[model samples]
Target: MTEAPSPAPVRIRPEIAALPPYRQGKQAGADAFKLSSNENPFDPLPSVIEAMRSATAVNRYPDASASRLRARLAARFGVGIDGVHVAAGSVSILQQLALATAGAGDELMYAWRSFEAYPGLAAVAGATAVPVPLAADGTHDLDTMARRVTDRTRLILVCSPNNPTGPIVRQDDFEAFLARVPADVLVVLDEAYAEFVTDPAAVDGARVLADGHQNVVVLRTFSKAYGLAGLRIGYGVGHPRILDAARATGIPLSVTAQAEEAALASLDAEDELIARVAVITDCRDRLAAGLRAGGWNVPDAQGNFVWLATGEQTLEVAPRFEDAGLVVRPFAGDGVRISVGEEASMPAILEAAASALSLLPEGHPARAM
Candidate 1:
């Protein structure tokens, strides 16, 4: 008798396969300058490195609770220990949030062309992802987003200084948006680049949530401000009960000892970090100006990066940058997003933008054609 073929082991969820992979720009070549991921170009503060070195104890497991780091974060944010929960990174905390709240029948809502992580997390939790389009100005259309929140929507993600767009939601507008959203719907304000924001109207989610709002949570990362990207430390602050539930669902021992030490030291060096952020913001503005001078439709950047709103696939322009020894992020169908990593990369970025524009049609952002 013919042997029966073994059945294929079923994948965890169909949605996992359906979701597109997060595309990253190439950096394999020796001459390549990778600016794809939004990582700090500057080395970690000397004090931060030394602190991590002092805490490197390989044989022992990390503090499962990350109590000291969490406590420090709580003090820094002026929140209680119960309100703050530290994790491997802010992305990790976001993963836990999706797993804990969204499931097979639920939906996770966020802006399209935002952080690519959200849809992946939602898929892993067997949930549907609802992506709303941004306004013509590339800002979240809050009115439309509020309408998208149905009974099946369990989580709403707001990325202020929104990735790629770099615009913050005005405080009054956000409060009005919050007022319209149902209390049961969890609203996550991702302020990863909050430190760089100079906009007076930027919504301080901490203030809103701390004022007794149970539905809102604020996510911040040490990777951006403290220059601890490799160490991977980030946190979420919200209602104590909400954090408690999230804590119960999180992966144990996510924060390492070295990260804990670096985070604490970085907090101690807040003033210095803030100054560095200002430099980066200046760089971002400089980049935006340079692009505009070249006739690119560059948007106002409120973060450590500038965005070139080509409103086309980034892959089309990526090769031009690659040829010039720089690797910048390219979205498949949207526009190119470039991070202002260092003072040195500015010239290269401008050259690449000029080259790429030459290849596109008229009225293109770069006018290279």
Candidate 2:
């Protein structure tokens, strides 16, 4: 039966109404390698699976504070119990931090082409998003980001090994940038991919926090390195007061008991989990090197992904990879991000990248010098 068309959707914030919903990585067909999300290609540890099985208490709500998981993370980072907060995912913590710090008329600043969720989080808080464009090599131009800050700026996000385009913010550069930012302004070091980094010069957020960056927060996740993406658990380490503010904004009991148990188990099995990360990073390096050898200007990828700055050709180039049974993430008019997927997918990736490279116009920036 034809019903009255739902009266133009209920009134909502104009900014949020204007914003686009967050888009996830495309799912691949059964025969295709899903390289769209920068996810761990490894299977979960049996220990983690067993923990989840034992944690089956769907009939009851989870611990609101996730105390045990928080305690473990706190001990690992030498932080106080109150200073550690666990949430559904590190991305959820980002939104919590945004809501806790920024509001209407305030500003949430970050690098462009970062995690796609950043803008929507800011909009949800009724805060203005100030996105500083990435440098030509797709790294954050911290100097300019610091300059962009003003009295209205309440929060800043620094995504190391910047997503989509891979490059870590060097320790020297980050410290210099931090010095210029006001002490009151909160800076979140989004290190979801920290485990994959091999660069000695990269800014280790844990070290930076220990060095006493009072306003700094370090966010990490079991979703990426620990293969807990399906479980949805991550943690944040920061000043107790800052974490308290974020904790207050969180939805009670959103983190499930199963997720918490899997996280604890993943922590117990961290050594083996990290070895899997090493394999992915090794694969990432090989992929980046192969792309470079083929005259594609791949960045010094420290994450489990490689960026193909296909530029304006993204729309045309991404589908070619898809045709080769590789589903990749493409940011139209910007570039394509190809995650380092299963080892079996490597040959397809290289072949697709080589073909995409041949499709680029003469003198495209993505072409090697």
lDDT tens per residue, model 2, 37-94: 8888888889989999997778988999999999988998998899899999999999
Error of 2 at 150 (Å): 0.5
Return the TM-score for candidate 2, rounded to 2 decimals. Answer: 0.97
Q: Best candidate, lDDT-wise?
A: 2
Record all residue pairs in model 1 with backbone atoms less than 3 Å apart, i.e. clashing: 296-365, 357-368, 358-368, 358-369
Give the range where candidate 1 is weakest over 10 consecutive residues by summed lDDT.
Answer: 360-369
Give the Cα RMSD of candidate 2: 2.5
Clashing pairs in model 2, backbone N/Cα/C closer than 3 A: none
Total backbone collisions, model 1: 4
- lDDT of each residue in 1-369, candidate 1, tens digit only: 999655448854556656667665454465666687777777888998889889867789988878887888787678888989899999888888888789999999998767878779788888888999887667888999999889999999999889877788888888988998999988999999888889898988778876777899899999886788888889999988888878888889879999889999998888988888888888888888888888777665787777766656466777787778777777766777787777888899988888777666776543433
